[model samples]
Target: MTHTRFPKAVLFDLDGTLVDSAPDFIAVINRMRAERGRDALPLAELRPVVSKGARAMLGAGFPDVAASEREAWVQEFLDLYEAELGLHGTPFDGVEAMLAALEANGTTWGIVTNKPEYLARKLLPLLGWETRCAILVGGDTLPVRKPDPLPLLHAAQAIGVVADDCIYVGDDERDIIAARAAGMPSVVALWGYRLHEDDPFAWQGDVLIHAPAELCETRAWPGTGTQA
Candidate 1:
């Protein structure tokens, strides 16, 4: 259903929706592989799983390793990635413009992501968004993360907005599921990372956008009303 009013807040997933962090992931994972004497996987092969977090990337880069070992490797990967955070990767094209437009229009925006709070916060200064982001709720900020809805709910609360007054944008199925559970409208970010086997349509977001610039268009937002 199309909303007739502009949402009070817009929430986004950090890794894929707002930032193209695959380069950092690729760099660190490749470095880890090199340490293991394994050849580095191509960027194309690793980009899709970047949003799935370190564990997924580790499994893809080291498929031969036992699942039990992956748990330990996840911490190693996160440690390495934290040290190299913001060394590569930037906001997706048009993301800054979109955010600027939102602020100019008096619409508040925040980030809710599965990335650890400290890591996600570290990116703010690099992008010059340290003072601009309305709120930030990370995976570890609460007992549950995306697909659980609590993060989304807490983000809206943190920003002093109701769930129905917020719209969530994300690249993964779990994002949409969480938005739905939180009673917030959602937009699927088609420009973000996703496996070739993934079907965005199945996520059933209120809207789908192929590029960050599209977010500037009122039609790309969930509500049907003109920009507030």
Candidate 2:
């Protein structure tokens, strides 16, 4: 049961894991609020739910909007976010070094996110990931998304890696759920968004990392150099 120091590949969750896109989300939400004369929400208040997607974000930004009307609100949020995408977001600290190390070692990597395919694709060049990212599977790329495992499995195959040989890094509980179901090892990104209610330990990830920098040192990886 030995493992390679570096997995065959690493699959990341875009919003919270690889990139700190919360600022972009906040900009969009705040702009929407300002249009209605509402004050801006502190970044801290909205950061925790960024990975939960548009509806959750709109829920916080427009509390007065009825649940039934959320469908329309969500679209508006997305439209604004799409326009704001790549304008404010940047890779999380240490992510560049980690990805550099992976590429230096010839370990392939990709993104699997719940963001719409068009948006994710549109975000690639802006984030300088258009050619760097080996593969991408958006929320709508497949019939189902994370918490379903299909996206993770498909991403692995697309990059020529088997599920068990890949590592999935994400900020949400559903990320671990999908990785586990797909037979890939999961790393819980502690630096990613998590409300006070989130208990990453309870998620039972294979590894829990405090920052993207932790992955920069190849020897520091769990099971690194352990493979026979």
Candidate 3:
């Protein structure tokens, strides 16, 4: 693995990367289905699509709902999800310890997600991260979101860190792509959600970690230039 000086900041993708938000997605979708006299979907069925966002979750939840109309349901899905957000969501196993490690190492961290800014802000307090998180760049925070690379670059700049000094971590292909475009290093969170056929190795992240606990290892952070 390539090594460099420790990163000044570590920017994360919110939903699947930092938090296990699949439960909340299940709650919102089941609630919506129940209201419409439909059956609830299982977490296993919907979990993989949570990172894909509202439309994807809804598509799985309401398969009967046409793809064309799923876009329209996005607002309602997000609204209901806003209420159910942190109630069912928690940091993925080891996330707390990982954050603590970052703090102990004097490295700053923030979030850049496709979730809307208002919704992301609401989640901070619910997750008890309102004060601890250094910065947030939501999908609506900028003109474009991930895969565009601007949001990742913007988040680094917002926190007064250069792109090379920030590391982006997420579970999606777009996350690695954006980091590459921004000239930033990236870590693929293999513990996060993905479809049955999804191949993370192909994402080509600078590092691929199986669990948040793996991040606690010194080797996971390339900047230290030492194997754990």
**Reference-based lDDT, each prediction:** 0.88, 0.87, 0.86
* Candidate 3 global TM-score: 0.94
What's the lDDT of the predicted structure labeled candidate 3? 0.86
Which candidate would rank higher by lDDT, 2 or 3? 2
| Residue 166 in candidate 2, Cα distance off native in Å | 0.6
lDDT of 1 by residue, 8-73 (tens): 689999998999999899888898999999898898988999889888998888888987898888
| TM, every model | 0.95, 0.94, 0.94
lDDT of model 3 at residue 223? 56
With a 3 Å backbone cut-off (N, CA, C), the pairs that clash in candidate 2 are: 5-224
Instruction: Give the per-residue lDDT of model 2 (tens digit) for 1-228.
Output: 333456678899999998999999999999988998989999988899999988888887777889888777778888899999989889999999999888887888999999999999999999788999999999999999999999999998998777877888999999999988998888999999988899999999988899888887655454422221
**Model 2 C-alpha lDDT versus the unseen true structure:** 0.87
Error of 2 at 84 (Å): 0.7
Q: Sort every candidate by TM-score, greatest first.
A: 1, 2, 3
Superposed Cα deviation of residue 126, candidate 3 (Å):
1.8
Off by over 4 Å in 2: 1-4, 223-228
